[model samples]
Target: MSLFVDSSSIRNFLRRDWERAESQLGSVLSDTMVKLGAVLNELANILDGDSAAKYLPLVGDLRKVKRFINAILLMQIEKTNLGRTDFDKRDLINLMLLHLNYPGLFRRIRNLFAVEPA
Candidate 1:
């Protein structure tokens, strides 16, 4: 589904998406920013990893970022510290931040596993 074809294209894609992710200000729900699709896609893409909750694109809400970080980053990476990860959702009061990963990871995964590109 991505447009990446080679090293050059991969760099271009990362630069473009990474810039877009950086320029973004994590303003909570500015109309369509809080939708399920937006949240899920952003998570799936792992955009702006390591950004604080209030700085991620559509995940600035301190009330809805826990599940993703817990399920994706904290769980996927097997962190030893259980409750001290990003997206500080202390006492059922917060949720935010994307997982840590470079933008080029997508292309690398595709290159390693994709088959029969049409």
Candidate 2:
């Protein structure tokens, strides 16, 4: 006799499998820190007054954002050294969503990274 699995059961199984896969991928904190570092570096390259003027209105004050990013990076480093995994996953997710929704900003960041230093 063959046992039939219901749709809900299959969905639950798939969800659990996905969670397991995510867990095996390692800490989300580290991934977010790396992404933030890339963004920060791109920002640093474009932070001169004239270059930052256009972006400031879209992203708020560039200086404040820079400080915030640095703080997050430092906190992540400390947590890692302490063997801690706790972090605000929502903040990282929201930051990613913000980037995704703002194509212009994302393009600017991508362009900055693409340019070769003279």
Candidate 3:
């Protein structure tokens, strides 16, 4: 047997891969949203539910973080909805994944709380 593949065969192979990856990404996004929601809920419970609102800027920051992640998820979810990957879709996904990276987000927020008001 010859070890050569035609262009169409390669295209089909890549297309199937893209579709599978998209399905997996959709599951990942859904699971991430669920876990994030649970964490936020747990924080609220620890803060005493309705009283969590009394925390002012901390509570505000929590809300902002939820919105931020939702936005990122929606962007990253675009390729999954299309069920395919292309140059454009991959660009958005890559950037969103970077945004989801650790410590930068945590450190930035931690610094805000670390300030000692004069």
Candidate 4:
């Protein structure tokens, strides 16, 4: 339900339908990134020497999420070499990304394909 709203907002943005989709994703990724920063900062303060080593994966995951969000935004507006008719998935970090740009019946079909795990 909520994901459909998100995808529609993003599509509106890419199609230059800005007035209504202005807030689009509503800073969801930005908010997540900020929390990641806070976690990293806290880890830095409490971790040191040998104990700090184990927290590396957590930090890495945070960074990956931050990058993933940025990548999605960037790719949303990009056109493939085939022209403005299609979007390329080779560079998209999330499979859900490609689904958003498709139109009409395809878009609905894509929604089903990109469904999140239950």
Best by lDDT: 2
Clashing pairs in 3: none
Q: For model 2, what is the error of residue 2's alpha carbon versus the real structure, in angstroms, after optimal superposition?
A: 67
What are the RMSDs of all candidates, in order?
16.5, 16.6, 19.8, 18.4
Candidate 3 or 1, higher TM-score: 3
Model 3 residue 36 lDDT?
A: 38
Better of 2 and 3 by lDDT: 2
Top candidate (TM-score): 2
Predicted structure 2, TM vs. truth: 0.28
What are the lDDT figures for the candidates, one per model? 0.36, 0.45, 0.43, 0.38
Residue 8 deviation, candidate 3, in Å?
A: 58
Error of 1 at 36 (Å): 24
Clashing pairs in 4: none
Stretch of 10 with least lDDT, candidate 2: 6-15
lDDT of 2 by residue, 8-111 (tens): 33234322443354358665455654555444444444433354544444334334453445455555643343224454443343344356457688678778
Per-model tally of clashing residue pairs: 4, 0, 0, 0
Models 1 onward score TM values of 0.20, 0.28, 0.26, 0.20
Residue 11, candidate 4: how far off, in angstroms?
Answer: 23
Relative to the unseen true structure, what is the Cα RMSD of model 4?
18.4
Candidate 4: where is the Cα deviation over 4 Å? Answer: 1-60, 75-87, 94-118
Position 23, candidate 1: lDDT: 38
- For 1-118, candidate 1 gives per-residue lDDT tens digits of 5322333333233334433543385533333322322334444344334433333433333223334433333333332333475542231122222222232664565567868869
